[model samples]
Target: MIFYNGDLWGPMREETNSWFSRIYSARYAACTAEEGHRNLVLTMAMDLSSKTGKELELPIDVNDLMKGL
Candidate 1:
């Protein structure tokens, strides 16, 4: 199980083509994009491990895993 406490405000904020971006820039901003990306990779890894009936050890450094993104 994974627990995430980071802010999702940035990713949840509605996208726009005009001044709304600037208007809510600071009000709706967080590190959710990066956190979501990491969670996606981890979820995939867990799914694959379960499908193969094998224990999954995350041997790779998280920073290294995130570098490609």
Candidate 2:
């Protein structure tokens, strides 16, 4: 049940518990440790909005930023 970087999760909740049992599994399904780690480095390599060339735009409401907010 522990939360990892951003929306990542690892290890198991119990001996019989698989990753599919967790709520965040779907988000990290395609992201492996190596890939995620590499992407992490790439993400840190960029300055916020610097590589994008233009300012990032908000696609949704500020008050509704979160999944359940």
Provide the lDDT at 29 for model 1: 41
Residue pairs in collision within model 1: none
> How high a TM-score does candidate 1 get?
0.40
Please provide TM-scores, in order, for all candidate models, with all chains considered together: 0.40, 0.29
Q: Report lDDT per candidate.
A: 0.56, 0.45
Specify the highest-lDDT model's number: 1
Q: List ranges where model 1 is wrong by over 4 Å.
A: 1-31, 59-69
Q: Where is model 2 more than 4 Å wrong at Cα?
A: 1-28, 48-69
**Model 2 agreement with the true structure over 1-69: per-residue lDDT tens digits:** 566674544543452254455434554445577776666444433333464454434333333333222
Error of 2 at 29 (Å): 1.9
How many steric overlaps does candidate 1 have?
0
